[model samples]
Target: MKQLIIILFLVVIGCRNETKSDEEIDETVYDMWGDFTQVHPEFKKDELPESWYFHDNKEDANRLADLVMKGKKKASSGLYLWYKEANADLPKAGTKSIITNFDGTAQAIIKITKVDTIPFNQISKEYAAMDMGTNIEPLKKWKKAHWDFFANTMKQGGNEPTEKILVVCERFETIWPKKQ
Candidate 1:
């Protein structure tokens, strides 16, 4: 009885000390944003960029994110229907985003340089190559991977994936974690 209560109290205190408070987490993100603005000095301090990671799978997401940090993968695409169905705003040029790791820690900041809506079948070989992580037949790889991803997304939205479906393509530059 008394021994059980003492053990529970010790566990609670230990957990509280080990866990990061919300303010501490927010400060980490804020510090990253601040570090970014220090180099550019054009972006305001109060407006924090949207933070997100790529891909649904954790390992895939981390790999893609690291590629972005390395400045190898400069572009990406998403199914427009996914945004519409979710009522999410479509990405636009000039907007900044904090690309995060699968664990939700900031990896780099990117500024969208271009945004275009293209039919899935119409994505150019050059653009597909830019979006891919590998040097091999990038267009083929991009088509296979994006097709599977878009099909899954469309199925969840109660829609069917088609070659004519629009994809929001974006090109960005990693502005933070600058060249050392």
Candidate 2:
């Protein structure tokens, strides 16, 4: 009985030491965001998806709230399950502004840049799967001008067009992890 008690005491103490306290865990998680920023230039807190639940810590919440109030933060990506309304004024292509729920009270405004587009020949195959159909012939006709604009923009940005597409797509996915 005595030996069992001693073992139990030792185990408790060992577990306490190994498991980080709440404060320590919070600091570690907060620091992880800082480290991520250092490595990724385009990463922003506001870009986190609406479905993402962040810590309710006052400091962290306040920081995000301040950014939202100032319109400095914006949603970049995500499954965005709660975003039922898509702004009609925003173009169906490229970057556009959006609003999403950040926390219960705070809302995040985000600039979403859509990197994917339907190829002219594949439009029929792509649209066939959708219930809603529209005349995308205009879009197909504008492909050359769009391609030229994209190419020139890439040149101006000093990025290879193919490389930029890959990077932007990856970055967009990172901001909004796919729904399980």
Candidate 3:
């Protein structure tokens, strides 16, 4: 009876401690987000199905998503230092990323055509305007808003955002759900 109890305890602990590969985990847990294609009604046969969102909050993600569908927003930038710590590779040019609404509804697909890194303040007004999602004019509001967003996001993650941080600016073209 003692040996049997020990064996059962070991089996339970082993099951509880089971680890899964990234793909396996993402596949199972992400199924609740719904089939990515279901969210993207206009997905084409040749395009790859992947998903991303603009921000952690639903309102911002959904807002940027609408702009993407309308082609008002054509580019985006991200803090590269975080990616470096995450050991994530840069998005390859010509590959697609399916963008989702804040609620996890896949809405549009974009094919990254170009990518480069530059200091935060050095970003051109043209690119900043292209990337800004709000009605706020980039020429007037880009630096302050971007600095606040980046600083708070980094601070919440336990780091400080600085102008020297390399921003991964990407220019992409809408591929799926092509305008109209």
Candidate 4:
């Protein structure tokens, strides 16, 4: 009788141990976002997607933003850089230029010397006039400068236009946690 009792006790303890181990493993698998929040306390109350790792403090947030911005700029610059290299042998003024996304999923074909107007309603009618001409030189310069500024500001914890865009995109890419 004692032998049987001892065997049952051991079996119970083993089952409990197995349960505990499973719980720990599950916690570990989901801890990446939790760990990020711990490091960045400011985001403790902010709602975020499961995949997003946001920082709480201004400094840390800035650092992450910078990294993301740099990545975006690198991606955009590569598009224009390729255009310049491809037309190196062609005449400068008449060369056609095209910039495509890294995945080659989207492209914009632009002609040099054509002027395009961008109107802004947020600003006064006189203040919102932006003429983007189809000069390859100016276009490339604008793209580089715009990307650099955006990346740097994002790194410094400033909000960016792209952030909203990312949020919409994430709905499709991420598997949201079930409601508690």
Pick by lDDT: which candidate is best? 1
TM-score of 4: 0.18
The estimated TM-scores of all candidates read 0.79, 0.21, 0.68, 0.18
Q: What tens digits encode model 1's per-residue C-alpha lDDT throughout 1-180?
A: 444433322222101112234554444466788887777687765578766667655787788878888988888887665555445577778888777766667788888899888999999988887788577898899999888866764555456889999888888888886334
Q: Give the RMSD in angstroms, all C-alphas superposed, for model 3.
A: 12.0
At residue 130, give the lDDT of candidate 1: 73
State the weakest 10-residue window (summed lDDT) of model 2.
76-85
Model 2, residue 63: distance off in Å is 36
RMSD of each: 11.5, 21.3, 12.0, 25.1
Q: Is candidate 1 or candidate 3 better by TM-score?
A: 1
| Better model by lDDT: candidate 2 vs candidate 3 | 3
lDDT of 3 by residue, 51-132 (tens): 5667546677778889888887788776775556545576669777667665455566678899988899788878887877
lDDT of 4 by residue, 27-139 (tens): 33235335445766865575432121112234433333333323221111111211222332211322222222222111222223322222111212221111112234544
Colliding residue pairs in candidate 2: 74-109, 74-110, 75-110, 78-176
The pairs that clash in candidate 4 are 40-56, 42-56, 66-155, 113-134
Model 2 stretches astray by more than 4 angstroms? 1-139, 162-180
Query: How many residue pairs in model 3 have overlapping backbones?
Result: 0
| Local distance difference test scores for all models | 0.70, 0.30, 0.62, 0.26
Worst 10 residues of 1 by lDDT: 10-19
Order of all candidates by lDDT, from best down to worst? 1, 3, 2, 4
**Model 4's lDDT to the true fold?**
0.26
Query: How far off is residue 72 in model 1, in Å?
Result: 0.6
Quick one: best TM-score, which candidate?
1
